[model samples]
Target: MKNTIFTITLILVGLIATSCSSDSSDNNLNTAESLQAVTDLALSGTWVISSFIESGTDETDDFTGYVFTFNSDGSLVADNGTMTVSGTWSVTSDDSSDDDDDYDSDDDIDFNIFFAAPPTFEELTEDWDIVSRSASRIELIDISGGNGGTDTLTFEKN
Candidate 1:
């Protein structure tokens, strides 16, 4: 009777442990379709720069009066009534690279921006990690590989 009870207890413990365990793969299984959903959300509306921090300094004023639009074609435009700047943007996921990158995870997603000219707008160009997002707001961050500085950018619906 004692041996049978011990065997049952061991089997129950094994079952409980298996039930409580989590699948790590599920956390790193970011798919392209989900990334497209995020891009679609950005394309849904226009936004304005609510905050910009570069190496602990706030620089949000640099984008004053500018409204940004992320189009479906990957074209990004910033208009400030008086002037307009054309750029490109993309939201991409790179699991393989993130495996070794300290700043990212296996399911890391990056928001990339590129502007050819205008030094002020050029400052926004980088592969920023998506911190959080909603219909009204989106937050991004980047840690410079060269300078070890942290930069943050936030966009809010305009």
Candidate 2:
């Protein structure tokens, strides 16, 4: 009877540990807001795209020489000397979909970006999950629900 009880307890502990473990996809989920109280303030000022990957392709060249300004008032600007694009950006934890919060949307915090003009710049638009962040660098990733493709974006303060 003593051996049986000890085995049962060990099994229970194993189960609890397994359930608590998070996979790679969930590693950075919902970290955007929790790490910083004022996300807008943290993201304010100018940034440049250090790296951008789209569908297994290196597309960072598309944004080369461009400077992005994330305004506190939800405004975004990208100027590459000759051309300038305007858009909006935000950091939010609202993961609700059309079917509401239960629509298989994890509680992942998102660094949302939106640019309307210039086809190349439009591709930067996505609700990217914050993978890592620091005073000078912010890394983001997004697994496309429609295509299952993984895209990554990195920004460095300039």
Q: List the RMSD of every prediction in angstroms.
A: 4.1, 6.8
Candidate-wise lDDT, in order: 0.84, 0.77
For residues 1-158, write the lDDT of model 1, one tens digit per residue.
Answer: 99999999999999877765644444444456558767987898999999999999999999999999999899999999999999999988866554224545314677889998799999999988777788898888888878889999999999
Model 2 over residues 1-158: C-alpha lDDT tens digits? 99999999999999877767755335454445363443654466689999999999999999999999988788899999998899998877654543222222324566789999888888899987777777788888877889878888999989
Error of 2 at 88 (Å): 0.4
| Cα lDDT, model 2, residue 92 | 73
Model 1 is weakest, by summed lDDT over 10 consecutive residues, at 98-107
Best by lDDT: 1
Predicted structure with the largest TM-score when compared to the true one: 1
Cα TM-score per model: 0.78, 0.69
Per-residue error (Å), model 1, residue 96 = 3.5
TM-score of candidate 2 against the unseen true structure: 0.69
In model 2, which regions exceed 4 Å deviation?
1-38, 95-107
